[model samples]
Target: MRLPCILVLFLGCGSPDQVQPEIKQLNEIPLNIRDKTEVDERTATVNDTLPEGWVDVKSLIPELVLDIRYATSDNFVGIQLYPCERCLLRKEVAEAIAVAFEALRADNLGLKLFDCYRPRSVQEALWRKVPDARYVTNPAKGSMHNRGAAVDLTLIDQNGHEIDMGTEYDFFGEKAYHTFTKLPAEVLTARRKLRDLMQEVGFKHIRTEWWHYSYQIKNYEVSDFRWPCPGQAL
Candidate 1:
């Protein structure tokens, strides 16, 4: 069954209450998408090595751009939090994102992922640095990212340059809020296009962050499993 659409409209007020209803609906929605374990079972014969419900997105969508900020020091933390640069998500979420990419590609646009499927341990470490819930969710409570069902990404143009979204990824401020509309007209248009496309593909946007989206059709537990780093002992 197809998931019910969750439309998020921003009024440029930066009020969390405006987005709370959608967030609440995310948990209340009945399961419409296939379970991750089921997907794992079906794909087991095709590729038996990957963990159930988890996939490296680049393998499924090769043309999609990946700039995993946490794997490098270019993020807000200014530290390499991840072991490597890879975009991993629950199998269903990955597939949905791949479809979104195809839609974007048809328009000569593309996606550039910043972060995905963050390990719970990493969340704890991040909390240690920034304990405030405004910026980092407490690891004890966990986040959609810990469940391999969330993504931080932005749109890229045909030339592969990231389209302006008012601020850079991981910018924790009012300026990063989807309701903040004092930016250039082009930036607003880019953000809306991305938001509309992602929501159409079963993803929901949070109020505070323009680049973050979480798949809502199914729920998964927070995980501590870390992806292997290149040339590093597991």
Candidate 2:
């Protein structure tokens, strides 16, 4: 459902109070979108704002595939954030990414945006799908994604095919670990370039998931907001 922005003071580190109660109680949250009417109503609640430089996937970039549900849906078991249709990000980040992609494109490289501006419900959906402490975070707390400052991305070739990253997005295995040093040189270089540019532009990379990054620093808080804003009327 479309929600108002929940105003939260930025905490350097969250308190014990923010710690999720327990995985056992997590089932209290709904996990599936089985009812079409309910799903439609909930989807309507999502604030589909197209931030500057953010393109509507259906119109501007339909060729890109959204494979997020593989992990959360019955059709797929892979853990990944599904693609968002009308979500957006800062124009500056988009420009920087376009420039970086230019460098790749000259050599026949392309960029694939897996997610941006995720609704909190979507985040909670993921939390319920895989509550294992090893990978997914508990929605009872928070996610960088809820802040609208992070993104999960990977590379695509000129032909629109995904480039090999040694492991899939959200793959909780050793291969998906950024510190794993056994990958090929090209894969490492690609990851490094992505990390460098994102860091340069104010995004922080998560160690466990290479594709994920966030602009959670102090200044960029202007862009950081909670999805389904709890306080505001929709």
The numbered model that scores best in lDDT is 1
Summed backbone clashes in each candidate are 0, 8
TM-score of 2: 0.57
What lDDT is reached at residue 162 by model 1?
94
Q: Candidate 2: give the clashing pairs.
A: 1-42, 1-45, 2-45, 2-46, 4-229, 5-229, 68-82, 70-76
- Model 2, residue 22: distance off in Å is 41
Query: After TM-score superposition, what is the CA distance of residue 68 in candidate 2 from its true location, in Å?
Result: 5.4
What TM-score would each prediction reach against the true structure?
Answer: 0.80, 0.57
| 10 residues in a row with least lDDT, candidate 1 | 23-32
Model 1 off-target regions past 4 Å? 1-48, 230-234
Q: Model 1: number of clashes?
A: 0
